[model samples]
Target: MTKTAEAGAAPARGARAVPRSVWALGFVSMFMDISSEMVHALLPIYMVAVLGTSVLAVGLIEGIAEATASIVKVFSGALSDRIGKRKLLAVVGYGLGALTKPVFPLAGALEWLVGARFVDRIGKGIRGAPRDALVADVTPPALRGAAYGLRQTLDTIGAFTGPLLAMGLMWWTANNYRLVFWLAVIPAFVAVAVLVFCVREPTLPAAARPPKLPLRRSELVRLGAPYWRVVGIGLVFTLARFSEAFLILRAEPAGLAPMWAPAVLVVMGLAYALSAYPAGVLSDRRPRLDVLLVGLALLVAADLVLAFAPGLVGLGVGVALWGLHMGFTQGLFNALIADSAPAELRGTAFGVFHLLTGLALLLASVIAGALWDAVGFQGTFVCGAVLAALTAAGLLVLRRKA
Candidate 1:
């Protein structure tokens, strides 16, 4: 080909590549995750060992915090749609989350800890739907799955790195949990800064920027059956998988050192990060629901492994499976929501989906905590496996219907 033709083709090919905003959003997720995970890796242990809290308390705290985030997404997402401005809400959310970082180190009582977690998750809630919607808005539909996967991959990188960093700092500070919490504050601010300076919002034409609220009955009807079906899948999936706090709790009895329990998250994060991008790329080419079914099977396996494992090796295997499940499903679900909803209501779609899943998580975590107290850890995991299997069966039926 002529040099002029070749040059022209190069620009056309480049036009199909993933956009810069997606990468920036991924980094934003990464920084926030690093900040959050460092505290999370140690929070359960700190509560149980230092603050003398019960396992039930840990479960309740994690469940409530996450559920709050889920419920909050609906409002924030709707607001973003109403304003036709995603980045502003995202900035507010990230800022709130960053501000709450200091509270963790200062928390001495369960109430303080719970309050801080609640506030932080509210920040998460504020940002979650809008940020996800922003991803869909900025990227082309053809690259949606890959875009979600890229974001999930970067976020998981931070997820794993935070725990790894915490593990190192734990030893450095002689297992000082508070000091590690203090250090976590740094990344939260960085995440906000990145969001402010790096990512650009896609421009909507003046005529397209209507002042309609997503909550209207007419708007709700427009969301349709496909979107609700996705919500059903999310609800069932969330019910089968409770907070990762339970995983950390299980690690000690599985024979990990208390100081090293954070390593469990590190392992999960590694598997999640490695698999996310590949899963995203595959989903972009193949059937999304098919990829999700594989993820569901992995979750059932992970639960069974955890339910009957003999030692730390078994636990690690289970954790790795859980990570793989996350890598396979999470991004696909996001892409599905983006695909299923109208471009204008993407924020509302994510919000409703998160709200349903969040409610399920609250119930699941509470039930898991109760089971842990009543029938021991084995029983809790066995319950998870059963729910996961049920979810898998449901997905199969849905796949056929689709």
Candidate 2:
């Protein structure tokens, strides 16, 4: 068979076996998540208690950090498409992230911390779209959902593990947040090493390579209606879900001690890790929109439970549901994007999707924080429930139209 034909051919065994490169990419994601989450699980409390920042400040920083990453993704993804290369950019991004790990522990002032976060998020933006596009390139079409899910699953494992480690170190060292942050540097470097030595980028078929400038109007227009529809749904979903930092904040008032606060992420991460792969596999078999609707319903339920239910029990249940919603939706969105966009424009599609959704998240988080400061956590969560419910209704309408 010709090279293009061979590149497009389906794997004989189907979704049962994915390429080794996909697994390597998954591990790369997992290790990086572990390193990042270790610091993140405790960063809010550190800013509040140690640095004396207000809740609104926390919201602004978190929102700005993520929005910065999303913005970078647009350019990095397009650049990857333009050059027909993904691995080099991925390496650069991951390397930047690894290099930034030490800054978290070294920062003594709030300004320093903010600077660190900004730089770190830029690295995330650089890698995010290219890495995702690379996954789509390497994996067979039939296994895209499974590949994304598996990557998410491993990433979530690191997400929880980081917090778990931080919690233990806190107890062992009498809440030494800096020490935990320092140790996190280890996994960040490990992630960079794994990506450098293990993951391999697949060559694109001749027909699937983009022109000189993938970001031009004509090229973007080729992304088509289906891709835009997925982007719309993704935007609404992001608006309904704000920063997870709020969950940690909520844990404090819900009766958890300061040192044990990371438990919130631990619970949430476990739920996410456990469900993501299964959800991915299921999405492969079922109508993806139907699966996504269920995820939206879970988000609504989580918000209500968080808003009204009392005590740690309520917090646990709500957080678990929130994690479940993440598991069900996050990978599926990527899978949907891959399914909708042309192979040549996949990186651009992911970049645009992330950029729009990240802006929505910034808006949502600011609103959530303002509500928390003015009324209380209950008001913030209740508003989230309403938005999630509305998004679900919108999805149903879209389904009907489809």
Q: Pick the candidate with the highest TM-score.
A: 2
Q: Please give the RMSD to the true structure for each candidate, in Å.
A: 4.0, 1.8
Quote model 2's TM-score: 0.97
lDDT of each prediction vs. the true structure?
Answer: 0.88, 0.90
lDDT of 2 at 210: 79
Report backbone clashes per prediction.
0, 0
- TM for every model, in the order presented, reads 0.95, 0.97
Off by over 4 Å in 1: 1-16
Per-residue lDDT tens digits for candidate 2, residues 1-402, read: 112332366554434476777788889998999899999999999999988999988998999999999999999999888787889999999999989999999998898899999999999999999999888887777777888899899899999999998999999988888888999999999999999899877776566677658889999899999999999899988989899999999997799998899999999999999989889888888899999998999999999999998999999999999999999999999999989988888889999999999999999999999999999999899999999999999999999998
Q: Which 10 consecutive residues of model 2 have the lowest summed lDDT?
A: 1-10
> What tens digits encode model 1's per-residue C-alpha lDDT throughout 209-242?
4356787878878889988888888988999999
